[model samples]
Target: MKNVTVVGLGKIGLPLAAIFANCGHFHVYGADINKLVVDQVNQGISHVNNEPGLDELVAKAHQKKSLEATINTAEAVSKSDIVVVIVPVLTRENGQINYQYIDSAVEEIAKGIKMGTLVTFETTLPAGDTRNRFGKTIEKISGLTMGKDFFLSYSPERVYSNRIIKDLSSYPKVVSGYNKRSLELATDFYKKGLNCEILQVSTLESAEFTKVAECVYRDVNIALANELAIYANNLDINIMEVIKAANSEPYSNIHLPGVGVGGHCIPVYPYFFINNGMHEGLTTLSRKINDSMAEYAVELIEEIIGSLKDKTILILGLSFRGNVKEPTKSSTLLLIEALKERETTVCVDDPLFNPDEISKYGVIPFSNQLADQIDAIILQAYHDEYQKIDFSVFENCSLILDGRNVLNQREIENLGMKYLGIGIK
Candidate 1:
């Protein structure tokens, strides 16, 4: 079996490790600086918020001697035939891509890697960054030349948090290398791990753009959905029904509207394409329109509040999307911040997120009978628990704002609550 080391064990890294280990084709090693995560993985438990059966898989891999977890990067890198870096390169507040985490990860791997060790970057980054910057940095530090002494490639992770396992096993894998040999090795590695088809690109930029293209396509389409939501509101038309009818034609494609685009990719990735020296004006405009969705949701809540300034606001979810507890760069968090700016008391409820998750945002957790105590309820995530909640809980004269369009309008309105939904009134 080939040895592989995966860095950054947050949402993406853990599953990649589990998949490799489960197949019994590779001796997988996982490294993360977070001691808590390392300890949990060592015990065959997963700290990831949404992935299922991960804890068991980690334990099984460990028991079978196919997988190991570590807090040290050099040890993991030195022993592996290939090293996959899955670190986060998020877009900061200034609308620029930050590479501090990625740079540090490369430095750590460079310390112990030897000749013939394949370095594959799986993070979503700007075009030409791998071949131009990262590969050179590692070569300088390790006293090796990429494509000659060692190998380099870029294969961005393309799976959502909630459905990571299924997507990884089923989704097509894209591989691109600095040279022909690097591409062949990387393609072989992925093909061994996943049963899906692997598409080899001619250059690293093509592979990088492939990943960005997926998220940007979704961002622009969601922007159109949000735009339609506002237009439908003004016309007093149910946009959801209109979309369902329009979608009846197979050629017509319509995305659902939400409070905003949350999760890690759609909200921040377009900036990677933009601020990294690409003409980001169009993407910048798309991001702005998508970002405004949260504020638009807050405005709807304010209109619902009209004259009730002293009333309570209950935010139903803090995570960006449902079925996953990760709140990193979530638009729901933005809405909560906006509500605080309005001087309204906010209480957040999410079955997936621990109550302490909102402490950083200065929002309190709600108790029993959340529906009866709050004057306005913002159904942010549409978790299964939220659906199980009786609409009568908010029977005492309040408004329910369904951000995810997961609520049944007639059922909610029949309970004497005014229902307002994105793209659906």
Candidate 2:
């Protein structure tokens, strides 16, 4: 692919465009509906921060004159051979995945894309979405037929947020297409720059289903661990230690239970298949169990402390996951609201997000005064920075609820503080 157009220059798309440009494999044109993101890209500035080494890659891509951006999709599609769709497909209110952004992007691409252009969607979607829905939509709108006038492919973007650059280059990329011709083209393009294993599958639907299954599998496993954790808690046993011991058998690899599952993939991906009638009962149950972990943490904390009214609680780490700047779908968000409703004074501290930005969530930013007066501390996110801190310093808090099990309970107790971790009675 000589020229590439990356639509939706957000988390996944920004790094994608940069990678293509930085590797000198493709002259990348990024198209986003957001004017601010477009303007920042054109000016060699990063519109989104928090992705490590992304700023440098964007700057280099701009300096080399290998990358550019615009809000106009027609303009980019007209000058590109590969039209990569990297938009976010979010879950709707009624438990269905919304593909509005992807639909809009494909329509725009159809308006100006040349014959034989590969329109590869890297976004996660339910099985048969790319080939049946998107392909038909583009053909209807543009008077083009799939596998004849244009080609469609599904190569789900598997890279995580902060580790995108590394993951893109290292992790095996899965690609599939509408036809053999499109499959070869997509695989060849990825092979040129990624320097990682590229797995070519049979159909676009296969690739789409592959991504969905990967995320759903993790969600189910994590939910099992959480269920077991709750069971262990009732029996006065430590699930983490049990997980450690069980893993020595080499067949049992139980994941750790946390406050709740979060992030773009785990919390949302299962709904793609769940709402589509693929064992909806089990998937929905697992999702509910994982989702309820946050509420469970809050309930346990409230029980440990007689009443939370007027008591000051400090929450460590604002991001959904540890060390990530992403706050979307964070269980901590729910925890914060639940705590506030109980009339407890809550303050949050995270090295990733600033206090002012965190205040947008309607919680107090952590301060020394808040810390000094903190009646309890909830270690929700186990960021590496938080792990490095001495747990004994927060000597004032009577109760310490370690949500991620990052704290040393005995050590905290030695400082005359009570430590209450999840899965511990």
Candidate 3:
């Protein structure tokens, strides 16, 4: 509670570190392998963008002298009372969750960890990993018993990017510890430190599954939405209108349709449970349905524009979730590849990312060209600035394909522009 070290200063980790520092209750040290990110945080400049209120919070944290960023993870761990791990986990080619970075973090922490310190894993993890994998790794490396020599807990990060700070503070936090001592320590720390309600579970495995369950439920729900969107297309119906009305029933709540499922947790966390979750069929099906959405968007474009040969398509967004710069699993990447395979010209416009970044991905960067006779505009992400853009002034495009369903069909049609929106007729 006095000194906090948050490893991995990425999207969620950076915000979490800032929040801890914002309270001014602890001196927080952020550790990351990226030297640039570390430098930026030390200078009070935010490395992540599109997150409202983060810049101000970071500035305030710096001004208070309560937050510091460093590339040395061992140093951060040695000087802190609480060590929090928030690294990325990915699937290998063999279909196993890659815990390489997580293991490395534990090893580093063991090297410099102090006795009686509280260690928490905030990353999404596979079931039984806390007890079978990470706990033993730390014990063996540090030559200290888990519950006796030090403390351990699994408290998964349940928030996404766009509203992460608010979600982190508002959502109920699921916390589980290896032992009673560890449990009470974690409960007290989060309860006093964060603004969220804490839910303490009996075991570390249970807490790991809690986060996985939340993400998988949304994946299944969104898969239902994506599947229905496709069915609505076949029937010439507006899926968005149907969803809005269907949601009027108190018991029914369907997720909104989009280009595809993106972000760090939604598209990736399901795999953590897939290998262990009892009911795997529905989970696999959901993954299949969500993964194909990008291709489906491309199909709609091909149908509208006929031949895409030498056609220039102006893409509106790049980030996975709208209004954010991070695109861990953004469907925009898939859409870009599909269009390029068909010889379609791709022009991307994302205020979050510059033209140089866009060009690095092998696509024509957005230059606000919307100039005469471009093929079509693909509204991939519905950023705030994209809302202010006027489509009526452009005449070159054959039609507008709204991937995220943010555009008004009537308004665009009235402007003499042909409009095609996701799940909209």
Candidate 4:
């Protein structure tokens, strides 16, 4: 079996390592800086929550002795024939790509990469970064020529959190390489390892641009939906109904409008494209529109309930998306900040997070006893747990803001609470 090293071991990385190991063609080593994660993986446990098949996959890989985890990334790379780097590349507040994490990963790989080793980056990057920045770093540090001594490829990860395993098998994996030989190696490896269909692009830049373009399309479309939602509210029409009806036509593919768009992918990837000196107008404006939505929700609350200065508000679901624990780029963070600025008392609840964990954000952890003090409620995330929530417990709540537009209006109104939803009249 060929030895394969997978770096980062995050939500995506861990699953990827496990998948590689279970494929029966490779032995996988997972490397990460976090000791807790390394320990968990070595012990055949999964630290990532809400992933359906990950725990089983990790356990199976461990039991089969096909997978190992370590904090020493370079050591793992040194023993591997193929190295896959799946680290994060975040964007700063100014919308500039922060290359620190991915740069660090590449530097470590450079320290251990040997001649004839295949190196592939699955981290989403600004287009051409695979060849320009990271490939050059490897060449400079390792003193090896790309496409000669070492093979290089780029394939962006295209899976969601809860259904990563399924998505991996379902979606056609996009693959690209530095040269013809590198492309052939990458295509063969993924074919044998993943057993999934591959869509090979002509160049590394094309593969990188594909992922960013997907994100940009969603961001811009969601911004359009948000704008239309606001306009619908002014016209006393329900935007949700209009969207459902319009989407029935073959070409109308409007995404649902919410209080705001959140999550790691949609909220951050646009900045990668924007900072790359591409068309800055639409992407920049979409980001501003989505970012302003948290403040918009706060304004809606104040307009309905009159001055949120002293009112106690409770926000349901702290995670960026429903049913997932990650809070990266969550709109709830922005909402909390906006509410606190107005001197409003804020409380948060999420089924995925404990009370102590919720308290870390400097907000009250929601409990039944605190319900009486709540002046309003906002459904920021439509977690499955909230579907059956009894609305009557918040006896003093005068209004319920359905930020996700998923709550039952009739049921909330029956409790003598005024129901306000985004773009619902």
For candidate 1, what is the TM-score? 0.96
Q: Candidate 3 regions off by >4 Å?
A: 92-95, 277-280
TM-score of each: 0.96, 0.94, 0.94, 0.98
Residue pairs with backbone overlap in model 1: none
lDDT of 3: 0.85
Specify the highest-lDDT model's number: 4
Tens digit per residue, CA lDDT, model 2, 1-425 = 39999999998899989888888688999999999999999989987767888899999999999999999998899888988899888886577777788878888988978887889989998899898888898889888889888888899888887789889988899999899888988898788757689988998889999998989888888899899999999999988889899989988888888888887888899988887876557788899998888778888888878788998888898888887778878888878877888898888888888778989988899866556688888888888887677655565688888888878888778777777777964
Q: Pairs clashing in candidate 3? A: none
Residue 376 in model 2: shift from native, Å?
1.2
Error of 3 at 206 (Å): 1.2
Give RMSD to native, each candidate: 1.6, 1.9, 2.0, 1.1
Q: Tell me the tens digit of each residue's lDDT in model 4 across 1-425.
A: 89999999998999999999999999999999999999999999999998999999999999999999999988999898899999999877777778888899899999999888899999988888999999999999999999999999999998999999998888999999999989998998899778899999999999999999999999999988888888998898999999999999999999877877888799999988777676569998998888888898888888888989888999999999999998888999999999999999999999899999999999999988898999999999889999999989888999999998988899898899998888884
Q: Across residues 1-425, which tens digit of lDDT does each residue of candidate 3 receive?
A: 49999999988899999999988578899999899999999999898877878999899999998889998898889998899999878776444688888788778888878889889999888878877887898888888889988899999888867788889889989999999999998988888678679988999989998888989999999999988888898999989889999999998899987778877778888888776644459988898788888888888878876878799888888888678887667888888888888888888878888789888878887664555656788888788898888886567776888888888878888876678777875
lDDT of 4: 0.91
- Candidate with top TM-score is 4
lDDT of each candidate versus the true structure: 0.84, 0.86, 0.85, 0.91
Question: lDDT at 327 for candidate 4?
Answer: 82
Which ten contiguous residues of candidate 2 have the minimum total lDDT?
387-396
